[model samples]
Target: MPIKYIPYTPNTIEGQAVLDNITRTKRVLRYRENNEVYNRLERGMPYYEVETVEQVGKPSDNLVIRGECLSACAYLKEQGIKVDLVYIDPPFASGADYAKKVYIRRNPKLAEKIKAAETEMDIEGIKAFEETMYGDIWQKEDFLNWMYENLQAIKSIMSENASIYMHLDWHIGHYVKILMDEVFGENNFVNEIIWAYRSGGASKKASIARKHDCIYFYCNNPDTFEINTIKERQYLDKKFIGTLVDENGRFYVDTILTDTLMGVIHRVLDDGSIKNYSCRPVLNVSKERLDYSTQKPEGLVDLLLEIASNKDMVVADFFGGSGVTAKVANELGRKFIHCDIGINSIQTVRDRLVAEKANFTVKEVKDGVNLFRNPQQTMDKLSTLITGLQTKVEGVSNFWLGAINDSKLGSVPVYVPELIDSQQKLLDIPTINRIINQEIQNLSITAKKVIVYYIDIDDEKELKKFIKENNATTTDIELRDLKNLLHETVVNDELEFSVSKEKEEYSISIDKFISDRLKQKINEFNDKGNLQAINKGKKFDPINISEEGLELIELISLDCKNSEGEWFSSTEIKIDKLGYVIYDGEKSKDFWNGKITSKEKPLRIKVRNISGDESIVSVE
Candidate 1:
């Protein structure tokens, strides 16, 4: 029988452009009101924000932020700290069950029972209860939105030479891959490494058992990410072999030079020859060894770090389930950031890091940033940090900005702006366009002219009628034909109008309202083919801090099961600048105001202020 072959046809401009738009749009959506807190990780000396800075390292100076990864990413971005690498192992979403226990009432005995029930179910490995509980807490749309928003912030915090590895299972891996391609360009796509592990779950029905996970590796820029050489020991033998030969003219083990002090050699029974040789070069042998794991091994990670690792590389992992990447990065002396909404997974990662003795610091940034330090007390002001870093990584940062900004429109418009560095003259946008388009461009329709619709009404009925009469789809119109349909009207937020535009031909460039002078300046840079400003800063060595920074001393998580996590029963407490109130739930409803002593774990105990000085609060 002859083989019937089929060829893949990629999306084109003549196809459904709406789908194209959907594909191009970043998956992350942010609630602006909630994302503004991402601004103060290490920007300044926060203690100077007031006269006195309280030292609350009771749990330990080492801290770990315990919160949702989506919100965490935004907060980290606002801090303006550069991350070197990120690795996360998120839910595979392949119907695998994850469970956690929650106390429903104030009864400790009941809580224990519930906890025991939860534990029993987990031990039994039942999926019913877990699915039921988790399903009610999250929706598909919510997950996708949260994923997108965090990915946005993740992109912002990475250093130029950084790389990110996102791990996923079969269910959402494909969706995440497509989203990743859009966020991190197709050009930046590095690898889709399959992590094959031993003793995975079994598929007892009609299908084969599953045994592997997927890891998507992407870089901020080509040739900029880290790559390290894999290492192998030189030999397997523990004892050194001698270079001496037997008197019988055969190479054999001999100890003629065993006694250097006596300078004597004892004759062996087999060969009655006394050898006076005392000076012989020591002999050594070497052996080669290879790592034996199908999935990413420590050796692989080590190699990647060696090659792609850079100073302050922010590695982000949206999955962050096992925290393998983060763990490896930490061991190899690299910075890491991980994200996942799964509370159990977060706790597992924290525990694993603790067990591994990883040294790190964590802080919860409300909105998208934390007030790590005040601007006046900062090594440099917030603006200074932004502008200074911006000036240095402007080229890389601008490229990202342009890519993200242009994604909203069709393509990044061809424009000219002022040149900050002379080396930019060598850059070829056409080449960039060619490279990017080869991987993701649609080739169906071109924009002959831009028609600004000022109103939310469609007078395109005539155009539709014309298209209907012509027996053609609106997407089939040629560039010449497109000019004839050009019309303008003012539009509001809600309207029913459609543009039958195809993906290829020419991309449309839309600009929001900006001063003509600014546009003109940008145009000049575009026309002149200006390049991004070169980074000029002194390279500093990585700080060596003890493991004290990464410990999770004690956390005071709240519980308001019948109400909300935000609402607590407290009357005698006052809200502080940080918006937190201290209250004694067991005793009186009295409260005190002070910044959290540590974020590794929260405390519910009230802190008293004496002479408005935290020193008065005894360490005990």
Candidate 2:
């Protein structure tokens, strides 16, 4: 299938941007294939070691990764893991934010507090209770660029007979089809399956209602692609009631039947004949619906899986929204890999697979580890730690103020060393010296002392000589060890909680919860100058040693099964203004009650904050 070309004038800004991004994508792909090298196994490095969550039979068969799809796919390619089938339900560039509706358990005290805060809670107030799951809002040019990069990364890990199904809607499907042709080649293009379904309210503004999503299927090699002929059973009881039986004792519909039975063949030995199945949208709610907005039915995924790949073949879904693809693949006994960027997505998929007793390993992959070391990762960690400390600190911002050269210490200019000269290769010295020169020149005009943070100072003599030679008599330079700062920050930043048991019920009291990531977000909101958001962020204290802190918790799920096994949702405690959990046949309960007898096996508990961050605690 040939891709339809859309004309664009290069003089226009949007057109120029799109063209530029396409050129850049080609260059990036080339550079990555030629220059980038990675270490497959690095201890203590993020994204290397796969954490064993629950082992069923073997650890490597089923996997769930929490990370960006592009990097995770790249890592998979590095590990020499090839997949037979890939189905991605990527963002549709719909220019809207998606949120999940979370219900909280309510008690009389919370109800009274709600009443005291407002006379009556309205629909908007209820909406305020919802948690933002993921955002699909993106500019057209940016969205296309993102999709192109991800597709390039994903294509590298596809096997020779692999087939990919890209699920999308009317929004950007056409544009993506053209991009896919560029990446996967036009000759490999297969089918454009239209999944039609009906749900929700219809828009009266448009004459025609948008009721279907488009799924573009492509293959690595069209001639050698793996495919199975799936058949749908045509009921013969209703149509062949008065039909004659053949010599083989089977009901026969004449081969010369009407054109309606075009592709169906007349068989002799069976009660019913089978015909090639047609694609249909999943209209009815499936039993696997977890209220995820972009969730697809397992039947739909099953059909795709059955047609494109066989049992025991490897399958992967990079945009694992609700993990329907993984769940369906698990049921069909296929090895699978599922990856997603959202924390809530990981939690939802983890809980779903655990409840189904599916064994899988979880891993977290983040950028910053390369063949050559980069200071950005360590600097980012330090920034978070510094911003999270609640006590008085010198010139600490709630957000990461970029690197030392570009960042500031309050109103004063600051220069942060890019690397420790002693620990790295000699090739990096010239670059370090250039950066030092730039920093010295920038700090020459300021009266404030320049503070440089470093992990080691093996080149201290040389650095001191350079500073002394460049000093203008008015400026002073101060050096601080990065390790000491990390230690100080770690000592102050800690989470406190206590647990008590009463027979089968367990109660957990959180003393405090502090996170630099949350603080950084609040600071970013404050930077945007949103007074309302800033106020809310300031009062955003979620965990404390009181019942009011419990109100901030969205869900607390317990796993009373084998602690070493997959975490099954044995009990859940949710808190909402008007919601309640039945306890001993009584509603409006505050504490969690687990039906567990022995805590000797170790208990696992997952606590989710309002912002969708999940913290798993193991109790022995």
Give the TM-scores of the predictions, in the order they appear.
0.37, 0.57
lDDT at residue 481 of model 1 (Cα atoms) = 20
Candidate with top TM-score is: 2
| Model 1: CA > 4 A from native | 1-63, 101-146, 231-327, 338-360, 365-620
Give the per-residue lDDT digits (tens) of candidate 2, residues 1-620: 00111111111112111334443232221111245532211111112333344343345568888666655765676567888899999889997767676543333354566656755433333322344565676667668866776676677778889989999988899888887877787778888876666553265885578777888899989888757754443335433555655455655444422212122233222345443323333333444556677777766777778768888999999989789888888888898899976656776776677656677877765322211111323344456554322322234322113323224442333334332111121112232343344444443244344455554353667877766664544546666555555554322222456677777656665555554444444455445445555767754323122333443355566676756545555555554334433321234533333222223333776666645555677765
lDDT of 2 at 305: 83
Query: How close is each model in CA RMSD to the real structure?
Result: 26.8, 12.3
lDDT of 1 by residue, 1-620 (tens): 00111111122223211223231212222222355222211111111111111111123322244344433444454445566666655444444333322111112232245555653212232111111112222234434444444455567666777677776667677777766776677778777766555444478898888766676888788765545422211222233465344444444444321111111123243344432311111111211111111123443444445445644444555555445556666675665665543333344455356446565454332321121111111111222322112222222222221211223343221211111111111112222222232212232323221111111111245533533453222222211121111111111111111112234321111111112222332344443332322233333222121222110011222211212222121122322211123332122221211112322222122211110101111111
Query: Model 1 reaches what TM-score against the true structure?
Result: 0.37
